[model samples]
Target: MLMAKLMNLVSKMPINPLIGAAGVSAVPMAARVANKVGLESNPHNFLLMHAMGPNVAGVIGSAVAAGVMIKYLG
Candidate 1:
């Protein structure tokens, strides 16, 4: 019971930093996902990335920002 309560509290804590670490850890995994999705074609294959996020917002915002950069500079 005590363990459960501890876990519950941990779950409610801010996990964004952890999530970011998870995303960083997922770099290789993201490449795999991109390959699976065919984003890994030709030159893109070398630069494509796959990642988990520290949080949903972080990942989504990163993606949006990347898109914007690509739109303007890619």
Candidate 2:
């Protein structure tokens, strides 16, 4: 959430900062939440697709992180 807000402030993009929250361990749920929040803010702001990118990235990132952790700690 903080990173999202910071990016929004720094980039000045029209993108909803809520999308950033989608980049979490709970991939699909986070994207859904972002979409829900965006819809609540504005009916026209459909952010599901936008949020998916981060959501997918989060999943991949988690996998990679887990691999690294296992490699070093397991």
Computed on alpha carbons, the lDDT of every model, listed in order, comes to 0.46, 0.85
Q: What is the lDDT for 29 in model 1? A: 59
- Model 2 agreement with the true structure over 42-73: per-residue lDDT tens digits: 99989999999989999999999999999999
TM-score of each: 0.29, 0.83
Candidate 1 lDDT (Cα, 0 to 1): 0.46
lDDT at position 14, candidate 1: 30
TM-score of 2: 0.83
**How many clashes in each structure?**
5, 0
Please give the RMSD to the true structure for each candidate, in Å. 13.3, 1.7
With candidate 2 superimposed using the best TM-score fit, by how many Å does residue 55's alpha carbon deviate from the native? 0.6
Candidate 1 per-residue lDDT, tens place, 14-74, comes to: 3222223334334455544544444434444332322233334456667888899999997
Quick one: best lDDT, which candidate?
Answer: 2
What is the clash tally of candidate 2? 0
lDDT of 2: 0.85
